[model samples]
Target: MSGTALQQVELVVRTIAQTAVDNEKYFGDLDAVVGDGDFGYSLARGFEKVLEGWDDIDRTDVGAFLKKIGMIVTSRIGGTSGPIWGTAFMKAGISAGPANELSGEQVVAMLRAATDGIKARGQSDVGDKTLLDALVPMTDAIERELASGADHAAVLAVAATTARTAAEATSELVARRGRASYTGERSRGSVDAGAMGVAVIVERISHAWTTEGAS
Candidate 1:
């Protein structure tokens, strides 16, 4: 039997939490090169809170669950990442509404809404060496592949690859926003830590949904 929508969301959350925990040191090392090095700890702490409160999350409504995640992260995490990531999740949740299940189109819309929320919160655009560098491209890839009638696994594969590539490419660009921007040309040659984190999260979430959890 297929997984329920609540189960799918739980899988995604678990994947994200695990990814953050697994890559904590790596993300901190990345941030040390271009910005303050607290990103890893902050993200991990926030996701840890989400895990601790998982049982309390309202599973009947996917949107409510996602919004609860946003609030948990925002309240627990520190720095700009808290607000940015929180806003992204909140916006996606809003786009999801109260639906028990989401279609591919609804998923795409959620991604788009999340991307827009990030932009609005960060005031940054693509190629700015921020998370948007990876997220925007991933969203676009998902939209394109879904439009082409790709299956869930196929679309997620393409999206994950695109996000990874985009994150890697940030090493070639100068930072235009955030603490990294203060480094000017020195920010080049170092991948944006936030972008890499976003890539990891997206890839894991996609894998969880397409493989272990739901369509």
Candidate 2:
């Protein structure tokens, strides 16, 4: 079970990295609507570092692997992207502790930890028109699905859809955080790039899970 869990984690993380790298231009375009247009580039660079050091990351446990990735991201990436994303991973790692196996509840706990960390690091929350707007609702959907006895596949599916809907809804919100917030009311009518990035990454993870993680 622990070995399978590790494999699943690796698959999910790898998918996230690939999605960030592949959609760099799309993400940048989204951010350019009201931001400095560096969100995608910054994210890609951080995840690229994760991929580059994948083989070298300490896998003593899930916590170590996630924490190591967090450190790499924090150190390698620049601007706001580094701190926001890195804090998420680090907090999740803290919740995961030294466990090699993660139960469904543990996964939720890790996600909550990550979300809280992001809120703290960015000083934002749901309705802030930040990634938290999408992330919070997606996490809620995931928790509800899991509580109903859904499996990973079901949770991933729900989360992906929820994230997309939530991200798209951000177009109606005025940005309250990040560089987009600097534009004030002008930030309306544009989706939050980080939220959309989460949607894309979760969608890819869901697809990858269905195709390659049924074991």
Query: 79, model 1: CA deviation in Å?
Result: 0.5
Counted clashes in each candidate structure: 0, 0
Where does candidate 1 stray beyond 4 Å?
Answer: none
Model 1, position 22: C-alpha lDDT score:
83
**Local distance difference test values of all predictions, in order:** 0.86, 0.89
Estimate, for each residue in 97-210, the C-alpha lDDT of model 2 and write its tens digit: 998788888988999999999999998889989999888999999889999998778888999999999999999999988999999999999899999999999999999988
Could you say which candidate leads in TM-score?
Answer: 2
lDDT of 1 by residue, 1-215 (tens): 15776676678777888898788899999999979999898888888888888788876588988888888888899999889989888998889989898887998898889889989999988988999999999989998998999877788789888999999999999999999999999999999999999888888877776567523
How far out, in Å, is residue 100 in model 1? 1.0
Q: How close is candidate 2 to the true structure, as a TM-score?
A: 0.97
Range of the 10 consecutive residues with the lowest summed lDDT in candidate 1 = 206-215
Mind sharing the TM-score for model 1?
0.94
Q: Give the top-scoring candidate (lDDT).
A: 2
